[model samples]
Each structure stands twice: as C-alpha cells, then as structure tokens.
Target: MPVIDQLRDSLGWDVVLTDDADRDARSHDTWPVATVWAKLGRHPHRPDAVVRASSVEDVVTTLRIAAQTGTPVTAWGLGSSVTGQPLPVAGGIVLDLAGLVSEPVLDEIDRTVTVAAGVRGSDLESWLGERGLTLNHSPQSLGRSTVGGWIATRATGQFSSRYGGIEDLVVGYQVVLADGTVADLGQRPRAAMGPDLKQLFLGSEGTLGVVTRVTCKVFAHPEHRVVEAFTLPDVEAGLTAMRQISQCGLRPFLVRFYDRDEAAHAVPHEEISAPVLFLGHEGLTSVATAEHAAATAIVASLGGTSMGAAPVDAWLSRRYDFSTVENLLAEPGGYAETVEVANVWSRLAPMYAELKQTLAPLATEVLGHFSHVYDQGSSLYMILLGRADDDETALARLEEIWARAMKVVVAHDGEISHHHGGGLARQPWVRESLGTGYPVLQKLKDGLDPAGLLNPGKLGFGRR
Candidate 1:
C-alpha cells in the first residue's frame, strides 16, 4: 500500500485534513514575518496535511507514520507564537494538538498540578482558582497559549521575577519521541539523576519530541498583595535600582521598568515622558507587607520618586494588550517588532546602549523594558517602530533593524534569545550563539531524529 494510503487507513480520514482551506489555515503562525509575507501575496511553508490530534495515541500514530514515510511533523499548539516557531517550513504534516485536553489533577500535598499539555493557560488558571490554588505562570499570551507551547518554548510569565518561568514551573513531562517511543522524564522534585534529561526538551521547540502531558509546581493564592509605582530620571537609574532589589533578597513578583517612549505607549492618555517603574508583590500577609516596606526604603535610598499605585494598577489592568503590534501592522507604511536578549550585569548596560543607539537611525522610535530579572542580570526587551512606502522597502528596513540589533547583542556576548527559543526567527544566529556547542546540539538532534522529520529547519537543525 502507498504511504499516504496507510496513513489514511491508520488514522481515519476524518481526523486528517488535506484540502486547500485547512492547509492555508495551518500555513503561518503569529510570526511577524508571516504577516509581511501575507501582505506580499506569498507565505512561508504550509503543511501538505493537518492531523487533528485528539489524544496521545493519535500523536503516536502520526509519528509512526512519519517515521515510515519520512514526513516532517511540526506540532501545533494554540499557534500564539510570535517567533515563527510553529511555521511548518518542512511542508509535510502539521500535528494540531490544541484539542487534546483532560481535567487538571491538583496534588495538594505536593503543591503540584498535573495537566494535559493541550490545556489553555486561562482554562488551567480557572480550574485552579476553584481549588484555591494558582499556577502563577501568567504570560501575556495566557489566553491564547497552551501548556505544551509554554513548555516547548520555555516561556516566562509576566511575574517571572518571583513565581518563575515555565522552566521553573515544570517538574516533568511525557514526551513522544520521533520513533513513537514514550519517554517519561523526571520524577522527584530534586534528583541527583545522571544527566538531567528534562532540561534538554524544555526549550527544544518540538524539535526533540511532542510533549503530551506536564506536571508543574503551583502556589497558594497570596494573602496579601501590593503594587507600587515610581519614576526614575532615566533607564540607567532604574537599572541600578532593579539590580539592587534583586541582589538584596527582596522578592517582587513583577519588576517592569520601561523607557520614556514605551511608557507613552503603555498609557496613551496620560503624560509619561520619563522612564517609569512598577513594582508588585503578592504572598503571605506578613512577608509581603514587610517586604513592601523594605523595598520602598531601598528605592528611596536610590532616589526613586514614588508615583503611587495608580500607574501600576493602570498597567496591571491592561498588561496583556497586544493592540500596539496589531494596530501598527494594520496600518500602511507602518512597521514594528520586538526583540529580547539577555547578558550578565557587566555586559547588559553596554549592550543595551549599543543596540538602542545603533538602531535609532533606522527606527522612528525605539523603546525598551527590563523584566524577568535575575541576580546576575536581566532580560531586555526592545520594541522598535519604523516606516517605509512599500512591502519591499518595509521588509528591507525590518530585516536591517533585526540584523543591526542582533550583531550588537552577539558582540556583547549575550544570548540571541532568552525564552522565545531558537525558532525560524533566531535560526540564523543559533550557530553563532552556540559556538562550539552547536556541534553538540546537532549531534543530539541527529541521534534523536535521524530522519529530521520533527520541526526541521528550526534551531539550525536540518534544513526544511
């Protein structure tokens, strides 16, 4: 029998979609490059067929068929990616995993929750809310993203400074390898097991395997919460205060410090011309209240000007808004993109200054914010805006902006990406970023998926 015939017989054709409409719908994700390509009457690779995976068995079946057919398989979640991670550049079968969900089981004793990877972020949060527990993993894409996508991309929540990112939340997961083998990685909270295997798949972006289920740590609802706002004279001052706060052992769940231009975008109706900072804490009443006071003192000692919680509340009320990017793309002669990079404290400031200054000429406006901080340093997110008359000019300007920014970051010894993973957007730089490690990563990829059927072309893996 033909391979296509075997697939048609193994998984009922009802679960398979090969028509033009389904292929078109599965073509692109939220990758800004997709938007540009669409406007140009072109598109990235679209899968030849889409398999609606309703269960782990379905995924296993698909992989078995892929192994025999040498068909590229790119797992699809809610498709909320901005990094073009889900683009099916391999032109084979796209496994849609958004519909496979099971009820979340809360292990109250262990303070962990086990859930199917298909669960949406908002849905999981609501289920936990009924049980008086919270995941504390609230990324801006919460409503549109899935647990598997979060784990696959190694995503970070907005309150990552305290609650931690997906990597920190994930205890273990069930992955289906390229050969249809099921691997259950990790067991105990902390294991001295040889060669921790879970970390390899955390940010693998489906290039390693398909995550079917995930078990992650959870937290009790905070008994006390406080949100405070301040304005620094400039970003340099704000950066200093943040470093101090992180180093001083004060835990602020959210530490969002935006430059002047970004502040204007954060609150359009108000006048926020200077760099702004928002600090928020939520935990035990005793711990939170005392820490809030201590944090205030520390900020005051650093000459921070208190602006009350009004600004903080305003930002909290609309933290997940993506209107800026949406509206900009909708308008003609308008272009904008956001790039995030990270480095040690010693190199962060210099890299930030270099990239910001270097891209200023090409961009009409450049805005930045430092969030998801660590004791050593922090992640810097740069949002840039530019304009050109046509798609050709616009694309050239956009590519130039990314190139200039990436060169500066690489020169400063910063990782090209912090959490978004090395998808198509960062594939070009993965080799340079990894240095000697690229060969090791390639060896790992070859050993796992020799056919190169899983998310091929991403992360500098096999070309699609």
Candidate 2:
C-alpha cells in the first residue's frame, strides 16, 4: 500500500488527504516570497500528502509510520507563519494539527489554562474574556494563528511589555517527538530540575517535535485601561523615553514608537511632523492611573509633547488590520515585507539609521516602528514595499533585499530575528546569527531527529 493508504488504514480515511487543493494549501505559509509565489499561481513545495491529526494517537501513529518509512513530516497550525516555516520542503507528509482541538481547562487557582495546540488565539482570548480572563498574548496574526504556532515560533504579543511574549506565558506543553514518543514536559510553575526541556520545542519551528498542547499563564482582564500618545522630536528621543520608562519599572502593557516616515503613514495627518509614541497601561483603576501618570512624567521630561489618547485609541481600533501588506502583496509586480530585529539600547539608534539608509535605494518605502520594549532594548520592525517589472523580478528583488538587511543587522551586532522565528526566509543567516550556538542546535537535532525528517531544511537544520 502507498503511504497515504497506510496512513488512512491506521488513522482513518478522513484523516489522510492527497488532494491537490490540500497539498497546494500547505505548500507555503504567509512568507512574503511565498505570497509572491501564490500570487503567480505557484506552489513549489507542496507535500505529497496531508494528515489532519485530530487526536494525539493519530499524531503518534502518523509519526511512527513516517519514521519507519523515512518520510518527512512537517507540522502545520493555521499557516500564519510569515517565514515559510510550514512549507513541506521535503514533500512527504504535512501533519495538519489544526484538527486536534480540545476544550480548554482553566485552572482558576493556578491562573493558567491548558489548551490544545489547534486552539486559535482569538478564540481562546474570547473564551477567556467571557470568564473575565485573558491570555494577554495578541500577536498581529492572533485571529488566524494557533497557540501551537505561537509556541512553535516563540511569538510575542502587543501587550508584551506587561504580559510578556509567548515564551513567558507558556508554563508547560505536551509534545510528540519524531519517533512517535509522546512527552509531557514543564508541568510545574517553576522547577530547579534539569534544563527546562519544554524550551527545546518553544521556537524549534516544528523541526524538533510537534507541540500538541500547551498550559500557559493567564491574567484576569484588566479592571482599568489607559492610553497615552506622545510626539517626540526624533526617534532617538522616543527610544530614550521608552528605555527610561522600562528601566524605571513602569509596565505600560503597550509601547509603540514610530519613526518619522512610519508616523506619517500610521497617523496620516499633516500635523504629524515628528516621531510618534504610544503607551498604554492597565490593571486596577488606581494602579493603571498611577502608572499612566508616571509614564507621562517620563515622556514629558524627555520633551515629548502629549498627543493625548486619541492617536493611541485610533491605533487600538485597527491594530489587527493587515490589509496594507496583504493588498500590496496581491498586486502584480508589487512586494512588501516586514523584518524585526533587536539589540541593546546603545546600538538601536545607529542601527535604525544605518538600516533605513542602506535600504533606501532598494525599495519604494522603508518604514519602522519600535515595540515589545524591555529595560535593555526593544524590537524594531522594518517595513519595506517595492515593485518590479514582473513576478520573477519581484521575487529576486525580495531575496536581494533580505540579504542586504541581514548584512546591516550583523554589522550592527544585532539579532537577525526577534519574534519571527527562522523559517526559510532567514535560513541563510541562521548559522551566523546563532554563532557557536549553531552547532549545539545541530547536536540537539541529531539526538532528537536522527532521521532528519522533521521540517527538513529549516532553521539551518537537517538538509538545506
């Protein structure tokens, strides 16, 4: 029997799919290059089959068969990854884990929730909100992305300044290794035990194993909320204000500072002639008020003109709108992409300036904004849009742009990726970015996935 037939025999016929539509849909994720390929009706890496595993046993059986047959099995969430992490490059089996949904179990006393990997972020948040709770993790792709995808990519949310990224929110997970072994790790709040093994799969991009379920921290919905916006004379001043606020231990829950160009695009007002900064605070009424006041004082001291709550409110209203990038990518001969990188505060200003200057000639527009602030530094998103004469030229230009951006990032001693895990888009620089850590990753891959079948050729792992 063929592999698909065998999967059906073991896991049910409905669970196995070999249709062209299913294979095509799993070929590429939301990666810009992949988007371009999609626009041109091309799916270069479609899997030979798709297995919609609805239960852990289904996953175990599929992996066991794949391992026995020397087949590649790449896990799929909602295909929201922008880095091509879910592309079935090796063309064996695409395990569709989205069907593995489980009713979330909330631990009111522990302040955490155990949810299946297929749970959509927005759905989970809505479910928690009904009970006066929240996951407090809202990535831009929250509506479409899954909790498993979040864990796999090491995702961060907009409210990360106060609540932290997915890594901080995740308390434990249940995963299935490459050879059909199911491992449940990190069941406690904290442990002095061996290296938190759950971390190995946190950002592994499904190269190490498949994340089936997650137990993550949850917060009661904020009792009060405050939004503050400021006009900074320059990006440098805005960065300084953010650092001071963070270092002062005032958690705003949301901190976004846009460069001049991005500010104009974001605010879209002739009066918006300077960089814009937006801060938000939430908690008990009194606590939110106090933090808002303190953050306002810091911004004022830095010569930040108070723009009041209007701008921030405007942003909050449409925070999840991704049509700008989507529409641009859909257009013929058009290209758009966003790259996020981070470093220490001292190097951020120079790095930002150098990146903008270096990328000026390559694209029609290069805009940036800073968010996910920490005491040490923050992530900067470089948004670029350009056009070419044709699809082939556009794809080539995208590669060139990434190559140039990575060089500038390395020169500035900055991380190549902050939240967007190294899908194929960043594969070329993963080794350089990981440095000595690269070989350690290789060892881990070898030890766990000795057959080199799980998500082959991603994150500088297995085959390239």
Candidate 3:
C-alpha cells in the first residue's frame, strides 16, 4: 500500500492503477487455461498494482521503486501472451508498455527501422508499406503484439524462411535491468563481439530485463511474388517434402504443411481431400522463381498432388484470423489452442506422431502443421480442439491437453516450445528443456536480478 501511494505520488497519480476495474482488466493474456482460472475466481497471481508506463524513464523509475521495495515487475505489452508470460503471478507491478510508442525512424540507405518498443506490429507494417518497404515479420498476433513483445518472446513470423525470425531481424535493443540500469546491445549489422548480450534477454520472457527500444532490419517491398499449393498423403509425407526443400538450400518466403483437420479450415473445399501444403516466394524475381520451382519439384517427386493456387491464396488472405480460438473461448464448452515444438529431422516424424497420438484421445480435432524450417530441423505447430458439456470439464480438458503435449515434447527430444516462449504455462518444463544449461539461466537471474524482482516466476527463474 505504501509503495502504491509512493508510486502514485512520485510517478504521477494517473500512471498507477489501483482501481479494481483496472487491475481486473490487466490480469490475463490469450491463454484459455488462465482464462478458466479467472472464471473460477482463482486469480492467485493477480498483480497488486498495474502501472501504465509512458516512457523508458517511466519504466526505469518503476523498476527502481519496485526493486527498492522487493516487488516483482512483469512487463506487459498488448497482453497477447498465449503462454501466460505477461501475467503477474507473484502479485507486484504489471508494467503496461502498450502506451510507450514514439515516432519510427526509417533508414533508407541502411534498410533498417529504429523505433521504440511500444509500436505494434501492424502499425509498423503499415508505416513501412506507405514507403514501399516491409519488415516481413507477420506473426498471427501481429495486430495486437508490440515490437518489444516479439523480441521478448523470440517469436517467429510466417515468412521466416526468407526474412528470418525476430532474433535474426533485430540488430540491437535497449534493455532496462532490475536495478534501473539501461544497456544498449548490438549496434552493427555483424559484430566480432564475443557473445551478443541482447540474446540473453531475447526469449527470456521478462525474467532478464524490460526491453524499451529496438533497431531491426527491414526490406524494400518485394518485386516478385509466387504462390503454389499441393496436397500430400499424410503429415509424414508432407514433412519429408518440407525437409527436402529446406535441405536443398531453397528458401521460400512461406512454407506450411497442414494435416487434414487443419487443412479443412484453411481451404474448406471438398476437393482438398487430404493433408495440404501452402508454399510461396517473394524477393528478387530470379530468387523467387528459383525457390518456387525447386520446392515444387521436390514435393512432386514425393508424390504430392498439385492443388493449384486457390487454397494457398485463400490461406494468405486470412492467415492472421484467430477467430477459431476466440469463438471457442466464447462458448461454454469449447476449447482450442495451438502448441508448437521443434526437433531435428531425425526425430521430426516420430515426434509429430507421438504428440498427435497422445493428444488424440483428449481432443475432438488434432491438426498439425510444420513451419519455420531450418537446415537441420523445423518447428511443428499443432492446433488442438476439444469440447465438454460445461466450463469445469472444458478447463480440465484444456489443461490435460497442454500437459500431455509437453510430456511428448520432452520425451521425443523436442524443445518445450518453439516460438511461444516459456511463460507460466511452460515454466515447469523450462528447466528440463535447458538441462545442464538450466543453471546458467539461474545464475543470470541471480546476477542481473539479485532481488528476484523482475518477472519473478517465469522460465523457472527466481522464486514465486
């Protein structure tokens, strides 16, 4: 109470939100499991106060005050964390960074955009589009997520194959630590630096520090764009096609192989009777031509039937629509979620089968799609759907699905999560995912946040 009064008096009374309505609104993310907890009035992790930070100075001051008082601070963006990363489970300060955006500075010569962290993805994209430039970072949550949240979560975009993920796009960032110290990390295109310190905070899910500004690589709008679609017999066959394409050194701007259940939602046509593949290319005309041709040849050799461009075009048009999850969440007995994991090609097929088989009994619809491919491996994004007669049963089903999927991910040598980041939902598995390296994270927590005050319970770092 004293800290709240102090913060209100010191940081401006308007910035501190102690009203019940305000705290209740900032309490959760897109996580349905957490939503269920809220519905049951089990908000044990709700924040004591929600602070609307107006600038980097505001962020620094709040962290200092919270640190001085031994309180946990969770950085909040658009609150779109599907993994519950933004939830202030330890009940301290939820630093809402949604209002801290500043004017974006674009460098035509360097092809980079320097902006504050509060800029939402859509706003950035629109600004770039006006200048015939693009960041090519289009995640499903683009419309709601802030640039800082993407860096914090280590998220992947749909066009990652050509443009790379957020980690690859970010040249540098400014992070405010637990003690109110600001560090500017990575300034050049490439550096001979020993270790990129910015990476320590990326995907740290607010456990390390609060990111405030970033400089990222951007691109001129693509001159050529190509789209292609195919129907594969099964997920294994689809994975094979994708793996071959990636291994052959062809980088398509978009590559998605969806299982039947998932395919139906994308195309929803009777002709698409099996698993489907959506492929595309965008960049120099020659590069697009070469990559698209090579990918088509690889998939055709694997017995994939060409399905024309209608389905792929359809997917592109509505890729960011999250209506399914939203609609389900609105229902009394419906639940759905997308969980993703990564593994090498050697274990890719088996891991996919194991995860689906384990989740099959608990779900009404289990769909799988592979994206964000690498030379050695790819990430699998699985959509799980289920229903019950009531909220209690639906919540139990949702929790069970996440629990089972996590076990399969660990048992099969897959990372607990590929792009979702380790939030409250994945906190317990973070240690196992890190193994011998887990202690390193703990040490980082101890050294950087000695008071255990920054996003205290995430990534299995710091005590709750």
Candidate 4:
C-alpha cells in the first residue's frame, strides 16, 4: 500500500487526509512566494497526505510509520509562517498539529503557563488577561500563529525589548523526535547540566523534532503604561538614542524607529520631517513612569523633538493589523515582502543603507524600521512593495528581491534572519550564514533524524 493509504489505515480516514483540496491546503504557508503561487493558481509542492494529529499518541504513530517507510514529515500549525517554514516540500506526511490541543494550565504562583502547541497566541493572551496576567507576546500574526509555530520559528514579539523573545520566554517543552521517541526537556528555571537540550528545537523549524507543548514565563498584567514619541534628526541620531537607552539598562516594553520613508507612512503628518521613534514602558506604575522619563531624557539629549503620545497611541491601536500587506498581495500584479536582518550597533546603519540602496531597483518602495532592540544591536525590518505587469513577473521580482537582500545582509556579517526561521526563502544562504555552525546543525540532524524525514529541504538540510 502507498504511504497515504498506510497512514489512513493506521490512523483512520478522519485523521489522515488524501484528497486534493486537503493536500493543497496543507501544502503552502503565507510565504510571499506561496502567495504569488496562489495568485497564479499554483501549489508549492503539495503533500501526499495530511495527518490531522489529535493527540501525542497520534503523532508518535505517524512518525513511527514514517520512519519505517522512509517517508518525510512536515509539522504544521495554523500555516502562518511567511517564510514557507510549514510547506510540505518533499511530499510525504504533513502533520497537522493544530488539532492536537490541551487546555492551558496556569500556575499563578510560578508565573508560568503550560499550553499545548496548537494554542493561538491571541487566545493565550486573552486567557491570561482574564486572570490579570499576560504572556505579552504580540506578533503581527498573534491571531493566527500558534505556540508551536512561535517556538519552531524562534519568534519575537513587539514587546521583545522588555519581555525578550520566544527563546527567553520558553521554560520547557514536550517534543517528539523523528523515530517516535518522545522527549520532555527543560524542567528547571535555569540549569548547567550540559548543553540546554530545548534550545535545539527552539528554531529547528520541525526539522529536528515536533514541539507539542510549551511552558513559558508569564507576568502580571502591567499596572500602568507610558508612551512617548520622538522625531530624530536622522537615522544616526535615532539609532544612537536606541543604543543608549538599551545599554543604560532601561527596559522599555516597546521601541519603534522608522526611517524617513517609513516614518512618512507611519506618522503621515506634514510636521514630521525626520525619522520617527516611539518608546513605551509597562509594568509597575512607578517603574514604567521612571523608564519612560529616562528614555525621554536620552531622546532629548540626542536632539529628538517630542511628538507626544498621539502617534504611539495611534500605532498601539492597530499594531497587529497586517491587512496592508494582505491587500497589496491580493492585487493581480502586486508584490510585498519583509526582510528582517540584524547586526551590532556599528554595522546596523551601514547595512540598513546598503540593503535599501541595493534593493531599491527590485521593488517600487523599500520601507525600513527598527522595532526590536537589544543593548548590542537591533533588528531592521525592510518592507518591499512592488508591482509587475503580471503575476508571473511579480513572482520573479519577489525572488530577485529576496536574492539581492540576502546577499547584501550576508556581506555585512549580519544575521540573515532575526525572528523568521530559515525556511525555503533563506535556505540557500544558510551555509554561509552559519559558517562553521552549519556542519554542527547537520550533525545534530543526523543524530536525531537519521532518515532526514522531518521537514526536509528547510534550514539547509536535505537539499537536492
């Protein structure tokens, strides 16, 4: 019998899907390339079968069968990855983990919540809110992305400056390795017991194993929040202020710096003639107030003009809205993609300029911004908007844009991706980006997934 039939026989028809529509739906993610493919009425390597796994036992059985048959398996959540991380590139079993859920268990005393991987981020936050607690993770896809997807992609949120990224938030995980071996890693708040095993799956993109459940740190909902906006003289001034604020140990929950072009769009007021900066602090009322005031002084010292709370408030109201890109991509010949890269403080500005200059010809508009910051550096988010005569041409332009952007980023010694995992989009440059680390990744993959069946063709593994 075929692999699909075997899956159906073992897991039942309800759990194993083989129809065209089911396979196609499980095939691609929200990758811009996939979006273009959708616009052109094409599928990017549909899976042979989609297993709607409802329990850990179901996952174990599917993986065991896959291992026995030497079939590939790609784990999927809500299909929200923009880098094609969930795409079933090698057509075997697409394990739909969204159906595999357990009620969230909150330990208020420990300030931790253990949730099934399929839990949507927004839903998780809402649950926490009702109890006067919060995960404080606010990704653009919060409404759609799941906990599994966040861990798989090493996701970060807008409030990452203060709360840290998924890597920092994750306390422990339940993972199912390739050969049906189940591992429950990370039991402590901190440990020196050899290397941290959970880190292996944080950004593995389902290549190493499947992340089924996660326990993350949570905090009491902020008692107060302070928002302040500034207009910097230029990118240099804005970055300098950001670096100082970060290095001085000020933990603002939010920081957004937009380049002139992006600022024009973000602020959209005639008085705004320079780069824009927005800072937000949240926590205990007194602490939030102090941080906000300190950050304000730094901005003022850097010649930043006060823009009050109006702009920041406006942004907070619609921070999660992604319809702009959605509507653009929905057009017949439209192309929009975001390339996010990061580097140390010294190299950030130059790399940002180089990327903008290099990618200028590839797209109609290249809007840049810095949202997530650390003491050492910050993530640069570049939004490319373009149009072509037809969908085919638009797809070609999208590919070209990514190619050029990656080349520029690598040349500058910057991370090819800050939060987005190495999906099909960044697969080609993974070797160069990881340098000596790439081989180590291969070794890990070999040891954990000798058959190379888990999420093949991603993170630079099992490439033909």
Give TM per candidate: 0.97, 0.98, 0.98, 0.98
What TM-score, to 2 decimals, does candidate 2 have? 0.98
Residue-wise lDDT of candidate 2 within 1-464, one digit each (tens)?
A: 37877898898878888889989999979999999998889988889999998888988999999988888999999998998999988899999988889899999999999989999989899999999998999898999899999989999999899989888899999999999899998847778888888788989999999999999999987889999788998888899999999999999998999998899877865467899998999999999999999998989998899877888888888989999888888888889889999988999989999999988887899999999999999999999988878878889888888999899998898999999988988988999988998899999999999989999989997652
Regions of model 1 farther than 4 Å from truth: none
What tens digits encode model 1's per-residue C-alpha lDDT throughout 367-405? 988899899999999988877787777777777877888
TM-score of 4: 0.98
Off by over 4 Å in 3: none
Query: For model 2, what is the C-alpha lDDT against the true structure?
Result: 0.90
Candidate 2, residue 170: CA error in Å?
1.0
lDDT of each: 0.86, 0.90, 0.87, 0.90
lDDT of 3 by residue, 1-464 (tens): 88898799889989999887778767878888877766666665688998999899999999999888888899999989898999887888999999889889988898899889999999999999999988889999999999999999998899997789999999899999999999999847667668878678889888889999989988888899989888888878888998889888888888888888788877886556689898998889998898888889989988898878887888888889998888887788788888889999999889988988899998789988888889889999888887788888988998888889889999987988989988878877888888999888788889998888888778887553
Per-residue error (Å), model 2, residue 329:
1.1
Deviation of model 2 at 309, angstroms: 0.3
Clashing pairs in 4: none
